[model samples]
Target: MCKKVFILFAIFSFLLFSVVMGNWQVAPSSAEYEYSAGDSFTVALTLNGDGNDIDALGFDLTYPGSLLNFRRAYFEGTLLDSWMFKQTQLLSEGVLRIAGFTISGAINSGTAGKLINLVFEVKATASDEGYIFPNSFTDDLAGATGDTAIFRVKPLGYSVIGYIWYFSNHLPVPNVSISLANYLNTTSTSGEFSFDLIPEGDYVIKPEKINDIGGSVSPFDASYILRYAVGLTQLSPSQLIAGDVSGNGSVSPFDASYILQYSVGLIESFPVSRDWFFLPSEFPLDDANWNSAPDSISLSPLDSDTSGLDFKGIVMGDVTGNWNGGLKKQTAAFVSYRIEAPHQLSQTKIEIPLKLNFNQATLAWLVKVRYQAVGSKFLSAEVLGKSENCIFVSHEKNGIINLAFASPEPLGNQQIMVSLYFEKENSLSDKFPKIEICKARLNETLAQIINLRENDEFQASSFQLLQNYPNPFNPETLIEFSLKKQGYTTLQIYNTAGQLIKTLISGPMDAGNHQSLWDGRDEIGNLVASGIYFYKLKSAEFHLVKKMLLVR
Candidate 1:
């Protein structure tokens, strides 16, 4: 009986070995796997046989050329005695060994019929054309089988991509969709996708998504943005101030405005997509009044009483600019007026001592003027009464009305010269009337400010992305570029096959000239192959793609 029992035990041990043996097996899920060029993946590893525990079991991964890359590795077990294992074989310094692995007893230990798993990951080459990389494993113990996983990388090429965070503060949206149309072509999967082969043509990228639910559809965020990947010849001005319809750097507002004119056609640049812009809160300006129209009150240098002439409580009509009065004295007239708070300017008579040539004069009408703030705020007055300029604030304390009735040459129109010396000594003492231009005419005032704008055009000092002096970039390359505004940006590298080979920076950056260096490897420290490569710049609104050659 003793002999028979021993035989059974021996047989059982052999069978267990057989089960765990025979070339370690993988999911076989896809003999070949395709992945996002710039994305990372996590996959599971399985063994065919069942064994409580297998000792002296490990894997050795090798890399042929600087082409393939390795990042990290892990070993799964159920041992209570925690221990960290150092990496024995590494292709390059880039290989990160995740050591010191100790599994809790919750799992089966050696001698049990449980399976153990070893996980690992590797990065792809930095080239456009996909490279076939094979991951092979070798088990020290004879019973376990060796396994390998294959991967194929995709590329993003000249297409630049970005996302818009569009969510309403009021509602809870489970899943949101941000889509793009028009000049920017996009393809999305359940997961991430890549954009490649973009031309230099201008395009409009607007966000379109469903809100709350599919049934409750709404417009995209007002502050939509686009990810741009400019290719080859970088657009002179890295930014498109207004009409960046294509989202690329070019003054293509003409395209956007044209699309607006052709209402019959599909609206390409309208803010309708999610990825095109951020939520409304992302807007940087003051929310004071993006919708309301200000009130406009008419003023005739003729009416001088506070009774019927006191225009208040009425909203202003859009101020219409009148050139009939000549450019020298252009007038913007409003129909309604509202008294901004209640305050009155001191009634006084003002006169001009000196007669001078006139260049420009702006006249406004209002109800009551606060006297507290003189030069800072506007002061109101009645017109045409005993005080030729009664409503007008007279700064001159003594010389209110210097009436010199002498020259008959300019006689028909009483040579009434008004002067006020209040601005010099009491700079901030005088109050200016609050003139709310017609809501419709608000744009006119803003335009006037523009017409008076000083030339502040920016000239980007450099254009071409200067290559790192020495051809085979040793450790790094000093990259330099200039920007007008600070924004989130990304600098990356891609191989000929269009795959994302490396990422130099991925974060919001400030405006002004910038310089970054690439160590010629990918996110993984593995060295890259020598060849023609491309680098791209991405921002909330700027996308530029430039090429570089890496000679191995």
Candidate 2:
């Protein structure tokens, strides 16, 4: 019901926007040409928009009827190809009205598309300022069930300016020779050059300098390409700036040096996916966004180039430019954790493996862990390795724990970010630490995360017994527990009626975490029946009992 209401509200909002804001638009904004009287041209009208659904539309267009003649309307490739009701009639000498609809119930959507082609014949000489105006338009259907959005009426007018510029040193290249159809001129000091007062025609402009080989204009190749040129040390001022090697705007000796490295095969070029951009690290900027156009390529020291996940589940660092904090960003999608054998009813230490998909050096990060336990008390946590000093108390609530840790410096040079260690005290039998990410700021505000396994490594903090892994033993199973002090311990199994079934251990045990094995057999070497059973650990001062299952 709520979903239905939300959908209704959405439809209502769309209708409101269409009725109030009117987002429909027309494209090409402007065009230009010099035509003699009687010359005719075709102007394709494209319906531009922000993708609102609409079935019917009507608009009033005002043009200079004396200067141009509007031929019969064409809808060969328009949304109104099968208009239920179509009208294209002149309301007055200079005003034309248009109305169209889709009886098949199609709606206009997407960026924009051709709606119609207007064939205009120059009736007589007309000023270049003549235009087509979407004076007013009504966007609606028969009822309010449809959607409409705010739209801007775009006007197409005549244009007559033509120019292009080349840039250098973050400024326009001045005095550069440019030519078109044997017409020649040098750019102004401001780096701008243009053609003006010319009759209407399409033209291509070219910039030229003394003969120089042209190759891919990429930073990764510029250095080598320039190095292989005839004169290694001397290039024309134009050639020097043309390389734009560093892309810092001006030509510099460093550009030549970079080329030499590439030419010698000392460095290689690579490509990155287009959907990435870089901003300063001082403030956390945009989220992960990628483009396909590709960004500039450059060379870097080989040592800082390793990143991604490794065999041990540790996150490798992103050494590339911190695109979306790739260097420090963690891939939350593949992120997961594992638990080693715990201390068995004692203090357990959880190892949080930090994994990554990329890294160049040590990646710095901060993580807030929120964890809760049913049979354990939340205890202190340690930031593994050199990053241990970065841990600080953040927050805590109920039985859950939150810990914050940051690196004093970037950590990926060694390839793996440090691991995290968490301790839980007085945990119940077989209870593993339950942890989650409250917050993770990789590279300050850019990064991924660590995976925490359900069963993790732990150190026994008190005398306690833990449930056995692979229980319901067929042949045998291991029962692990812990002791705080050295003592004589007895481990016995019994059936439902409290009858002794088997004794696995009846001797001295070490004062630390330990384990025992149990096979599904009674003292007489007879197979036990498939049923419920209980295991009890008894010492002079401590005793605990837990249930288990047996199968024949």
Candidate 3:
């Protein structure tokens, strides 16, 4: 009997305490708001409960005078499906009333949930002097008998005001977009993106539209140096793995190089090995780095800076090299093209000559030709006549043509040469028949740029080592050869015993027809009795020796 009495007393005391002090209290007790006269904002009504079931609710509210004009009331996924009474109306000129209740029985909104969303616009003349906006929400009064068995509710709200701005180069960025939860906004010309009304919930904001998408391995300014350090990259290890341009199992340096090559149309396959982590299936390599981890000011490595400043955007400070940043050119080569519509007819034939100046033997070469494609132009490129040294030639899409050449033997620098010929992309009666070699790669690096405008009078067809005019001469003779493009060129005269007699020409020469008069003398300028002599012309991919008679 004594134990039962003690338990009963304890229960009674707990119930009395529960009835005396409600378990919930509206949070953030107070807040303030300020905005421009034309700005509109939302006020979110929040309900926090003490882990109790709330079947129904009733609330009354009063607001500041003429400061805010109620626009709309909206809520989704709420506990109350039916409203017995709901409204926002002016009780008096400066005071507004909001009253609402739930119809059906017990609903549990434990801890927190949005009870209501109200949009309000400040009057054109509204000022920050008094900005006391929304009313204190109150809920407690019940039905006729006052049944408090279900839920004790608490209300909370916050003041929404000024927005955030995104700027670059000391100017506001316009049309940049960002969103949080259910709120979305676009930046104005002033670079300000605003969300006037929003629920106070845990939110993850997403940003977009700052710069053109571009490379990985971003070149860092002073700020990003810390952000992209080896172990401290702003990018996660996963993101760094995505920076692996070749998908070679690590975020290697080659990724940056591959990005730049892809941008310029040097490689057909994107990233050459498609395994990017972020939105891989959606974006291309054109402006790829913009997808993540670049830009100096943002300081956020996870978010990408889609601008032209990305490391992958550009590379090779001084040399022409492949994505490995290897295969740099010590010197440049030149190229030129000739197009002729014979007799002013569409029977156009195009030719391009090449000049390569290098010390090492060229292993391989790749060139891309872009043309103003006309009817049958694609057909013309594939079937165009080329030299026997060319191993492969094919037409790629979009008026691009790929030509490649490789030699089993080491073709010395001064022995490298190439020529291309095809019917012009234009048809019969076409005014401008156009095609140009846009890019070239030797040993997989961009061929250094050099001008090969040797002969403006006539375009060349191929590398030609023309016979010496007046071969049997007393004093001198002229040796001629067609310089298709710029390259290391050399001319030598030899005796019948194969000993060098004189070196006539040894230097870089532009594309065109070149001629040199070789006097009948040795390197020492000594004239001797001559029998049979040979003159040799050597340039990139071209080597020829012609027999000549010298009578002295």
Candidate 4:
């Protein structure tokens, strides 16, 4: 009887080991398929066990969150009804109807491998598009846990090209990566890449990831691809040599000398000139009409020189205001001057009734004041209610003196007016301390303009081949590096065969550091035969090589 019991115990131990060891394994181990835009692909999941009854195997998969253009999905099986899309919370299998059949559902437990399947509709976006499938199991094992699987749906027929531009004098941010899905192309340190050609369509271009610094990545870095037209054509010299800015067929000095008479006060207009009716000097200078007149000092024509500037307003605005254009002798004579348009204001003047409140404010009594927005196009100011006044002052193209009100504390229900006094050839410091009063209402103005100089200040460098993380990597590891500039770069893996085994990136990189997850797989996704693999980085100016090991 004791011998019989020992044999039964051994049999039970063997069965238990088998169930644990063979608990879960995905079929194909890895899947590879190419799809065009608006196309579909199929993937299967099979079980390996001694009749491990699985009522349901649910999956919660996410694409490269920023990459895939998620549309709809479906699954197959008796548990197809159990598949729920968490975001929309809709049953994926039911709503996904393509062709004569709904391509997604669950399989019957009896059918086993025959029942578990999925269909995905591909989007015609751009190169390097893909999706990841993560799965979970729901079975009679009760307390058992399941592992997830990842599957990729690659795009077909597309090429990817990377663009990189890095300039110094800007913030030196290197190590950036640009990825294109359909072409399966990623940029390295060189900032150059070529992808497989695919169908043309709009691609969502965004900085996939940002540098370690808190600075935001550039959105303008994104771009769309335009496919080739049916055919191409060339233009003749007459058609090509248009726009006679310098006129010779091409317009140049001869045309300008001939048209100089039209300039200045000599003639009303010129024949060759198409648009000049909007000149500022042509109109009687007034603060209200400033936005309409084109001037030499503004950004439109982008004048680098400003010599003689002057403006005489009959009456500046809703408030009684005046100025003599020059900065040395500025003037401000107003109970108040209110800004209009761009936005609206309720006050036009500041009335000083009775004695002024000197406890919390400083008032200035002036003969006159002027406002000007000279050599610039924006108006931003902070006004003071009581103490701490910070105002932006500038000279205007029309010779008006502009004042931007600024203050530290909030001005509630107070309408305060800043008055400036201008006298002939008189400097601001030489003017009288004007007695200014107000009902303290702070109107703050801030403009969001492109600081080209600042924008150009922070330039990214190319992606670099940093030392691989976990250097003597086992079967898995990570590679990291920074791109100090922009341009084409490459990260290639070479086996002992001296042949290129895999390409981690072969494209343009933005300036910043980036990391790639490498599993020591060859180009064919086969576990590279255990040995040594060298990764090389080649860019326009940088060449680096690093060695890594693969242990079986």
TM-score of each: 0.22, 0.26, 0.25, 0.21
CA lDDT, candidate 4, residue 189: 36
lDDT of 1 by residue, 155-223 (tens): 332443433221221212112232223333322321122234443333333323322222111111111
Ten-residue stretch with the least lDDT total in model 3: 146-155
Error (Å) of candidate 3 at residue 186 is 11
Q: What does candidate 4's lDDT look like per residue over 1-552, in tens digits?
A: 999999999999988865643344334223555555566655453444433444444333333433334454344452333444212232242221111112344332233332245455655445454434434323333233333344343444444343332221112112333333333443343334344443445442221223232211111111000010112333222211211212233323343333343333354333433321112222354434433333222212211222222111111010111111111221221223332212112122121111111112323321112222222222323233436354444333333234434445543324553333223232222222222111121231111111111122223344456566455777566666667877798888898678999898989876654445566776644567788888888789888888888777
Prediction-by-prediction clash tally: 61, 57, 26, 109
Tens-place lDDT digits, model 2, residues 447-507: 3333343332334469889765445656555566778888999999999999999898999
Candidate 2 vs. true structure, TM-score: 0.26
Quick one: best lDDT, which candidate?
2
Please give the lDDT score at residue 44 for candidate 1. Answer: 36
Clashes of 1: 61
Which candidate comes out best when scored by TM-score? Answer: 2
The sequence of per-residue lDDT tens digits that candidate 3 reaches over residues 1-552 is 999999999999988756533344332223545544556776565556553345444444444445556677665554343555556665665455556665554444344555566666766442223333333434542311111111111112222222222111122334545554566766554445444334334444444543222232233321232334445546433244445556454444465555455556676443424321212112233333533532122212222212221111122111111122121123454323333332332366544443434445666766665556444343432223434654655556666667666756555665334443455545454433244455555774455333244345445567888666555876666666777888999999898888999898999987766666666777654575778899999987889989888888
Model 4, residue 530: displacement in angstroms? 71
